[model samples]
Target chain A: METEKLFEITAYTENQVGLLSAIAGIFTRRSLNIEKLLVYPSQIAGIHKFKIITRAAEAQIQTVVLQIEKKVDVIKSYYEVDNERSCREIDDVRQFLQERETESNNI
Target chain B: MEQKITGAEAFWRSLLEEQVKVVFGYPGGQIMPVYDHYWNYQAQIRHVLVRHEQGAIHAAQGYARASGIPGMVLVTSGPGATNVVTGVADAMIDSTPVVVVAGQVPCQLLGKDAFQEIDLIGMATPITKWSYQIRRAEDVAWAVSRAFYIARTGRPGPVVLDFTKDAQAGLVDYAPKPCHFIRSYVPDPQVSESQLDEAARMIDEARKPFVVYGQGILLSGAEKELAAFLEKGAIPAGSTLLGLGALDSGNPHLKGMLGMHGNLAPNVMTQHCDLLVAVGMRFDDRVTGKLDTYARQARIIHIDIDPSEIGKLVPVDLGIVGDARKVLAGLTERIAPRTTREWQMEPILCDAVEKHKVIEPEIQPGTGEINPGEVVACVAEAVKGEALIVTDVGQNQMLAARYSRFVRPHSFISSGGLGTMGFGLPAAIGAKIAAPERTVVVFLGDGGLQMTFQEMGTIMQEGTDVKIVLLNNNWLGNVRMWQQLFFQERYSCTRMLNPEFTGIAQAYGIPSLHVETREELPSAIRQMFAQEGPFLLDVHVREESMVFPMIPPGSSVDEIMLNNEDWFNYGD
Candidate 1:
């Protein structure tokens, strides 16, 4: 039997309006939950990059990446394992912000 | 090198460049500039004035579906754009390509809650494949080019463009550039040979294999290819509602339709087949009742243009992403002709049960209370499979999908996914305009006719001859059937308080007739077709009749109720 896995998909495209929501709509229609998402301007001028983390079967995510690439606004989109992931630690960042809050209260 | 022009002129010129012969539109406040220009270019592009903007979109869908070309729509801001949301969503779900351009307030008044202003781009994004807000008249050509390209490419769907009023009024040099490609927007992906091999092997080895398809077949124009593939392999086929005409319905290898309210053999075969080959059709809930139980024993293979639909519903052993016709050609190329006698009883029993139990009793020719099925039968007989049958949602739509004899592709047009109620009236007009040589028939339920009956005026003015078959059951028959079976017969608002429909048709200057008995039903249908112009036939039918072999909600395929006895004998 097939089991679910975490997938990270990275997309590059010329920055245009409604590109993010259009990509998100692909995931939303399939009922796949995005674990994390990050989008920013690429190193190349006028080019933007997107990184999405979703938990689903590999085939499902592959289909998602394929759909994302079908958008004319999207330059290229593919899935990978590590570089595709958003490396920010969830609890560590939260704890660091909490410590900052405590120190500010003491001051 | 280029002449300057107004936004409205650029819009019309760009459409002319795109070879858009007709556009369904309604003029409004924010859309005045475009209409003002429309007055000048009525010769080049025919602007069909629909009573409501919603009708314009549906009409555009019919035109697109019939012509296999992108349909076009023009509506004003706010309510005009929003009114078409349903039809846009319908196009999106059904993969009908349509380009909708709505007027906006202006750039200066952006987000100020101006009159006749709404963020149409935002509202249309989820429903359309793509959308753009044209703030500058200079960008009009670029946006129109991209909108048409995107709307008609890959999996075809609706694309909306909202232009600011100032843009429509502004003057600029318009140079229409044909959209070639977006860096990543690949309309046709190469079919994976390995997946094709895998599917071919499975089809060859499986004792009992089933072929199921949907609208994508018609969209791809793969009817001939699908027929060759099925014939070469001697495979039995079933169709979703949209896939009806993709294969000759009378083909002996055709098992029948498969879904809720589908015929007997195909629905049951879904559970029993060893291998399930889905071509161009999604495994929608209606097609696969209780997915947990659907095709459990079968190894599944999906061939479709859209990758996202591959494993969205059912687990796939092999998923191929390509156009249906191309992929089917590739797969058939890999396998030699093979035949299997596995489960021969399945299709034979299905045919026997359908003919003996369903078709025989329903259409045995009687003159008592005029049955809806008989009306469909008579209309089908009158048209002789030559006309395009467009229908509004509810029982009438299902009956048209199920009973109508559609021998040609694009002959059956209806709101399949969104199931819009008043879709037939204006859509029939568009279909007539698209193919003026062919007859166009509009079937509307009592509940549906009341929704957009005003479009009769548009029909009279345009002089597009369409025969309107109104099956007046005096109730919302589909939902009422549901209430009868599942809701303990507690009829709520199912009953429709209808006006004198013939009077309403006469008011629109269309020849109208009323039929109450089976004796005159066929002649009335023939007379409607014989009329030189638009005609309306208000057919009074059995009040409680519903499409049979329905898979009750939350039930499995084998649990389909064949008829009233199946429902009554086996109570909820």
Candidate 2:
């Protein structure tokens, strides 16, 4: 039996103009409403990493990833279950900075 | 100083390198640089001055459809670019390869909303396989080469390259390098051995099997191999509208066409077949009448080059993502021959053909006047299945599709998915330009012909031999037929008041003949074909004729209206 779960798809793509919208269009066509999207320069100089989060069944996410990887600019793409992720958000750093500032004030 | 060339010079140089011989275009303020330099290269490459931008694109589509090569279209910016959106969408849906070049304002004034400037890349993105705007002159050669490669390779469609005025005029060091690879784009996905094994097993096991194919066979050039496979397997075949000419119309293995207004056998027998081997076609709603009841009993073996199309509309038991020709060749090796005879499958199909007999009188000549089907029949008899047939959408298109016999590949070209009414005339011009050796006949309605009638000037200027059989039904027969059948007979604006087409053709320096009665059609068609140059034969057809075997809207494939009684009974 297939059940829905959160899946994270990470892709490394050439930083070209309009490529973002092209990737977004893939998600839109699949009826996969993206819960989160993050774009930043990858380890390579000219390549960018796009990480998208959506809730879908396993078979559906695999199909979506194959479609994303088919784009000319996309270097590679893969989907992972929620537990497979190890990451941080800028919002978490902001909270840590606020906590340190309060500690300094208390001192 | 190192060698340097202008952007326009590089652009033209790249086309020469790509071996593009003909380009359909119209000039305006923004595209003057290319036009100015065009004279220098006129002897090497020919540029067709189309009357409108839409004609350029549709001609490109027709050229692509006829020749299996990427057609080229060059248009000015703004409205000129927008006018081609319809043809671009049509090419995208039908998978015809075309490269569209549009000139834009100078780079500095791109987003300032300058005169004749629009966001062409943004507008063309959804319609084309790829869209890009080159800001630098150095990018011209690479971009043009990539545009051609992308448009012509793997499931071909239209691609757009937007050129700014500065890019078209600027000079830079010129070096031409052919683009053979993109880092991430894979045109052919590797087919799996396991999938083929499973498919071979399914075909060998299933006793009642049916084959339905589409344009992919032509795209991959698998027609001969596919014919052999069908003959060996003893599987009956059906075709999509675009797949009409993939095999000989009279091939014994061919059952009939499959769609909304397709032949009765394939549509009726699809659900009952145990194994459905669909090649090259995506399961469009038009092909699959009602999704819930369409081939539900069958285990579908879908073979196509496009991976995404697999299991998109209908589920697949064994999906092989590869070129149709390659996959069919592979399947032929693995699957054993079936000894079952051809007559085993004939009884049901013969029954379907017998029921389809009602279509004979509707198209045949009657006492009232010349039937539209008779006009197509006359042309079919005259051409004898050798000419390339292009049809405009609606009544005329349906009649031509139903009545005509197509024996050659890529012989039937029209706007199937987009249903653009103005496609036939300009596309016929493209077909003639691409395949000058073949006889190109266009079947157009009075309504559709008027939409792109200006193309008569292009045909006259080019001096191409294209026979136009204008099926002038005074009413917009398809729309009126629908309103009469489904919409309580209120035909609001479907009635057309047409001008004298013969007179219109005369003004464009093309000869024409008119035939309104049944007796005149046969001779008029011969006259139209006998002319060495372009000629138009205006055929006046009965206003009340309706195409039969039509599957009513929101109805299953089995529920086809064969006659007036079927239409009336469904209303109750």
Candidate 3:
């Protein structure tokens, strides 16, 4: 059995109605209880941030993060061991979108 | 200056901006405002009034699959909204593009359980790509545009817009908000060049490689790309049930359908292949039985547009997240061409074994009551694999997928992920409506037909020219087969005392034919096609009929059951 650990998942998203419940529903479906939850504005204008702490297997967290990022309003999502300060994925997503814009412009 | 218009008019304007030509819908109290505006927009858009809300959504799904455009649905709140929940889930799992706008009570009345109001957003959130409630008329255009944008892009699925009565009645400065981009959403993911190189290297190194694909190919319009990729590599390919029409059945590299009750060649080769390349298909349990033992020896590469689907089920050595067309084109450019036909010829042996043991007996018994496979085979012959075939769940779906040959893309539509029983009748109607030039044929079991048989009225009213072929075995044949094989043949409630279906068809003004014997089968199918409008050919097949070359539940793909007494020996 894979050992369960407490992970912190952060998601940057568009401020859309019912997004809170929509994101909460994912954790509900997996029966993973959110230990702590925080929602506030991010440094990037118009983007909101959600910091959630939950206990789950590494595999579950990997899929959960991916599923969170799958939401239409979610810009970028990542997970890390509690208090590890891992690299942010939002910058990478921004870079990816910027490159796509450049490519489309060239076309 | 933009004219101030009611939200109702704004809704119609939004659809017009999207270039939507048709919608499948039924209206009631809360949504009456939107329906009222329909009178003015009637010149621009056509509305299909289905018998039920469930029929509306399934029809919409069929339209999307058939036309390669996002299908639209509009229904009232409460029961109307609740009715579409099944199809919303079906569309989600199938990756179909549909936008559903359901009416809601006035903004103030929400949460008070007002008359004809339900928590549609709450109920639809989990099932839909995006579910939002439009409480203000000003938000109508924005919400509708975003709904279409999200529903049609990036692994497309259903979207729900809960329209409140107050919002519909309020005034808005309606200018079309055509949402071309959303900062939060990326419809197309960029492919990694290094990943493509690794995939090419693996394909070049492997002597025996197998390709399993699903509806993603058709959804991505990657049929030509897939064919070119397979041809360049000399790789044999098999399609999932929904992936049937993606590759032309006549394509030389195309082996057959894969999964339980799929062909012998693909299922056996799944085990023997050294490298497995899966594209646009999630590793559904139905396709990969006993996952631990499935393709254990193969170095697997899974390519899909949905990032979450990459490693959700079957872990892969390389997972490419991009459109199938883009990825396949990239791989085709990178990979070396192979001219050898030795490994590709492997299916010949399995096909021979399947034909002698399974195919001949099931499709051409020569001396029995009409077998279901025979009916499918007869239709395949009559249509010459030129019809858009839709099927209800159970034995009908499997047999149609197995026997029906396809020469075109998007010619096969069935409820693959959700397995909705009453999907066929309405879906065929939608397909026929979307593509009136094409011949649309639907295969339905006796059990599934009655679930939404009232849609025959819709067919009658719309004058839909669908060929309805009822495989009337008078039993829940799929469940019965399971009972016969695994449950000591208890027979339970699987048996049904079915009503005279021809009489029902006659009542709906559809020309009908009942064929109980083998001699009448061919002419009945010919008559079905030869007629102008709708025709129902109810075939009374053998009650004890079974689909053979089966992989009993919880078994490996190669461990196939040829018949009641014999298991397929791979060596033979």
Residue B568 miss distance in model 3 (angstroms): 1.4
Judged by lDDT, which candidate is best?
3
Q: Decide which is better by lDDT, 1 or 3.
A: 3
**Candidate 2's C-alpha lDDT?**
0.85
Clashing pairs in 3: none
DockQ (Cα-based) for each candidate: 0.24, 0.16, 0.59
For TM-score, the strongest prediction is 3
DockQ of 1: 0.24
lDDT string for model 2 (B399-448, tens) is 78878898889899989899999999999999999999999999999989
* Residue range B1-572, candidate 1, lDDT tens digits: 77789998899889988899999999899889999998888888888999998889989999998898899999999999999999999999999999999999989998899998888887787788889999889989988988998888889999999988999999998887787555446677778888788888888887788899999999898998898888888788889988887777687678878888788888878888899999999887888888888889899998888877878778888989999989988877876696655576877766677776677666664546877877888888887788888988888987787788877888888888877888888789888999899899888899888888888989989998998998889999999999998899999989988889899888878899999878887788878887899999999999998787788877777677778775312212
Cα deviation of A80 in candidate 3 (Å)? Answer: 1.0
Q: lDDT score, residue B463, model 3?
A: 94
DockQ leader: 3
Estimate the Cα RMSD of every predicted model relative to the unseen true structure: 8.1, 7.9, 1.6
Root mean square deviation (Cα) for candidate 1: 8.1
Clash pairs, candidate 2, are none
